[model samples]
Target chain A: MSTDPTANFSGDIAGDILTTALDWKNAGKGVALATVVTTWGSAPRPVGSQLAVDDEGKFIGSVSGGCIEGAVVTEALDAIADGKPRLLDFGVSDAQAWEVGLACGGKIQVYVERLDS
Target chain B: MKREILEQLQADRADKRPVVLATFLKTGEQRLLYLVGKKGLKDLDPRIGEAARAALIEDKPRTLDTEQGPLFLNVFNPPLRLILVGAVHIAQALVPMAQLAGYEVIVIDPRSAFGSVERFPGITLSNDWPDEAMAQLRPDLRTALVTLTHDPKIDDPALIAGLKSDVFYIGALGSKKTHASRLERLTAEGFGPDDFARIHGPVGLSIGAKSPAEISISILAQMTAALRQPAATPASSSAAA
Candidate 1:
């Protein structure tokens, strides 16, 4: 099928995430959406950044550039399984940043919730 | 009732309606408000509703920190569209450049030969009269209309449509003298000086462009400036610089 330019959400991360979540839900795959709700000081991604995860751990988009996606993904997977929501706080401290392999200190609050219906 | 929001949001997205999806950070409560369509709820908190309206107007997604909590006002604006009234050499370059710069371009020319797919491969071509084409295209605030044709028959109708609508930027390709005459003609046709204020005559930023490609670059640059800075006026043909 020829791709319609109007239907393509390639570059828009927010639209892509929403589209992916809906597609996964329609495909019988449990899906969860993680969004960056708040950020503090040098957060890689600004607020409203999103990462959508499928039950199989397949994912697209990002809540952070790279710093906390892994953690968010893990939380997202759990959210999909439990059908529960999680608000994750990452890199609030220098020690936390070091643990997450972030050289600098910043904070990001990500809300992960399963996509229902 | 809740699934309705996502469904409506997707519907609005499909229809190219500008919307703001406001999600309360603390509660995950979501509300979708169309920027210019049927107002969803009259009872919505005035402050938050105003914030959503402001976000839609600004065409920027932002998280507003209110006394209750942080609300992520995600502005999903319809893609910016560029309506080129002439399928000339400048459009040959401008079409791709505008597409690259994230605009959906529509090339309008009543001349079937000039607007052929062979000339504008993979581009949206409208072979209708400029007024009819522009009426169908319905240039909104997110759209920029450029008339590269020096012909008044083509460009004047497009300019009239642009002036009547809220199209953010309207530029016409011409020399300073040509633009002065064009303005006079438009004024004679009932358009006032205030209506012509937004028209960027000579149609480009003055970087001493000499080629069609360079001229296209300047036009795109001016369009970008107009979209991003609606209040600031760029140097136009009438300006001394």
Candidate 2:
């Protein structure tokens, strides 16, 4: 909070995590991305937020509860290899927006895509 | 490695995504303690010569802004999104709720009247049909799809497609009887019993809520709990890296 109000956050690649991942793909590095679009009450995060994964399953963002990111990373690699994108879901239970833990009883939906360059 | 991760953090945080900072606290043979949230909240006490412990939290962790600058262990979301299959009253409420929660929400409906930018303000509204919209929006496990139309015509295809896909949570608004009817139609359309189980029919918890606003709150609350559970755990060693 000084001469630059934007100084608190990102310096580079802040606005384009998607592009960075795509750049990785363009550079011959396998890349996968996941996004949290919808969530229920008490969700820790919001919509349009993204997470990226390289061929190595290392992640860059979050979707929901963080329980299913590993799963999405694996799926993203598969998508990258095949040039396809997949949509995935998770929750407290198969019923009543129950994913796991998270007593607020909210639900979130994420999309995992393997961006092509 | 820290610099590369910092580059990713710059991207995620610049867009104002919901990111949590997980710092290494203590380390053992197969575990690491962590501190979550903005650097303003705590003092970093990483043991210089020792391995660190990284505790976990579900708030989209990101490691940027510790006293030492960019430390590892921060995890952010990948273009997080919220896809609303039905553009109805509940969606009106859900939009702001989702935005406040840090999701990039998109409202999709076949009816242009319902899905107009004029009505939605700053949101990304789509006039495409729910099924086609789901395909276009690409809802996944990191996203939540809620069918608020209460009409099978709108939510049916979206639910069927969403259930089939890996979308994290699939919920549709309806009463018990309506949900039962929905199940029958989906089953006829080749949706299996297991697939039916994936949907939060009679969506939202049994909060005994009546108003659309309350129901919206209940529904969203359920979804938030679902996503945060997994963000709280990840061992640096003895775990998948």
Candidate 3:
């Protein structure tokens, strides 16, 4: 297997994430895609930002400024296992946000869905 | 998202097509909307189509409340483009600045001496005539055109092309008198007041700029304004340095 993160993908950042998800899925690895669908108050990442995760917990791209990727990755793994879509809300007010270190005081809603045929 | 839908979206993006993916947050259902060419929506909600078009024009992703549920309209607009009709000194300054602002800059000048590679190192240089180059480029909504060459032979064709196309910004560098005469000539060619109104003669903001670099800064600022705030009235064209 190629060690390059973008070995089979070539495009912009968003395109790369989608391409990676598809590539991982075709390779028989469970894949889930997480996208930042909405944001409020100084969110580091803009809406439509994406992250692609594999069942192995390997990931590419980001939905936050490295503040909530771990939690998102955990959700992505569960999504891949259950083949169920999930909407994750992370904000400064949420207790889960403190655990996930979303210390930027901004809020983001991420949509995580397993890539299905 | 389904594998086929993802593939189609990737294919559209690869082809530089402006597409919007509207996804229902509750059901994870997705529908692709194309800004140009064939209509992709059939038996779908018209409100979704309207919102998709609005999102495309705004060049931003947005969430819309719908009868079904909240829909996320993810806009995938092609990268912004800046086409310079003249590879003049101002263009030499503007090209790098526009590139830094995330515009894919293309310098078009038929004159081999003026549009040489040494003058615009690591830039896309086109020696085709302004009219020919504009036709080939087919400036779209995400593109901006500027005519920097004072010569009517070069700038006029470019200005005409810019007026005919969907380019968001059309700027020409000249004095007020020159602009008047240029407008007169264009008017003689059957262009109306609305077409002339679209051209930003004496291009650039009313910054007291005399040097080529400063003038480039002003022009880029005007382009940024035209892009980000499309609804706002453009700055008056009288204050050209």
Candidate 4:
């Protein structure tokens, strides 16, 4: 918790993520944004969390606490290339969850969609 | 998909309208619903629009499993607002404090000198009369109304307007005797005790605050408590001198 009154964290990142996706698309770089649409149990992030990824694998924001960001980024890359959306689900059942120490446990569904200007 | 919706969403957000952008998971089709007021950009399925409106009212963002398929209803709310009915010394201290607490502060005072920018740097100033300005602002559930002038003419009308609205918090600054007299005047105008009870007279918590800045802190603390803990009982009023 920052004591600086000027430090504001109440802002939601959806608008910023969307604006970045649009700008990337307009700049001739394919872009896709992954949004956490659903969460069950102790999900690290809430629903509506977003991560924007360009064709070059550049990304901003996060849908999870590094537990599933890698997979989301890969899916976002595929979404940008195919111009189709992918709903990717990650949870404790997967071996990767244990590898990332996310077994504290929860399920998160990220909807990765391409952004075309 | 047209980028026009993105532009419109930006515009709606800039306008501080409560809006929800619902997107179909399968097709990536999106619809913008202005859920705060009845007005909308497009006429959507009544079920979805109503659900979106309910979500906006609850201030929640969620993915709803609808008959049309899974749709993510992303809720966007305007910044919380604090409308100060009087640009008194306390308001000068309160404005920046409220702004720091993530509230978009608006100060309303008919007296130009009192409401001048020099006294209240970087805050929205409304010089209109309290009743007129309150009507125009139309404080919603996300807004907090506070009157610090201690003048019945200025503070009473503003309190009436606030009482009529759905603003989550209402506080009036005055002494205990002044509050009783003020209550009498409002009662003479047909307002009952129940209506007056909604007000936190001798405004702010019973924190034994003396300085203007200290009082502002107490008021902001009370406002935050009212907003975050709606179920909690109101704090007891301290004797005002």
**Best prediction by DockQ:** 3
Q: Which stretches of candidate 1 lie over 4 Å from their true place?
A: A1-15, A39-42, A81-85, A92-97, A103-106, B188-190, B234-241
The single-chain TM-score for chain B of candidate 1 is 0.90
What candidate 3 gets wrong by more than 4 Å, as runs, is A1-15, B235-241
List, in the given order, the native-contact fraction of each candidate: 0.17, 0.02, 0.62, 0.42
lDDT per model, in order?
0.77, 0.58, 0.85, 0.78
lDDT of 3 by residue, B191-228 (tens): 98888777888888888989889898988988888888
Top lDDT model: 3
Q: Write the per-residue lDDT of candidate 2 for residues A1-117, one digit (tens) a residue.
A: 011111122324434565566556657787776665456665555544568788877677666546556666777778767855455555665442343444445556655555544
Candidate with more favorable, higher DockQ: 1 or 3: 3
Question: Which candidate number maximizes TM-score?
Answer: 3
TM-score of each: 0.85, 0.49, 0.91, 0.76
Residue-wise lDDT of candidate 4 within B1-241, one digit each (tens)? Answer: 3467766766666666668878988788887887445565355567787788776665667777776688888776667899998899999889889888889899999989899998988878999999999888878877899998888889889988988888888898998888889889988888997787778888998888999999999899988888767657363543254
Better of 1 and 4 by DockQ: 4
lDDT for each residue of candidate 1 in B1-241, tens digit (9 for 90 to 100):
1446766776776666678887776677777876555486475667777788777666656777877677777766678899999999899999999999889899999999888999999878999999999889878878899999899999999999999998888998998888889999999999987887889988888888778898888889888788777667554532222
TM-score, chain B, model 2, is 0.65
User: Which of candidates 2 and 3 is the stronger one according to DockQ?
Assistant: 3
Which TM-score value belongs to model 1?
0.85
Residue range B100-135, candidate 2, lDDT tens digits: 776788888888888888879987888877777777
Clashing pairs in 4: none
Give the DockQ-based CAPRI class for model 3. acceptable
Candidate 3 chain A, which ten residues in sequence have the lowest lDDT sum? A1-10
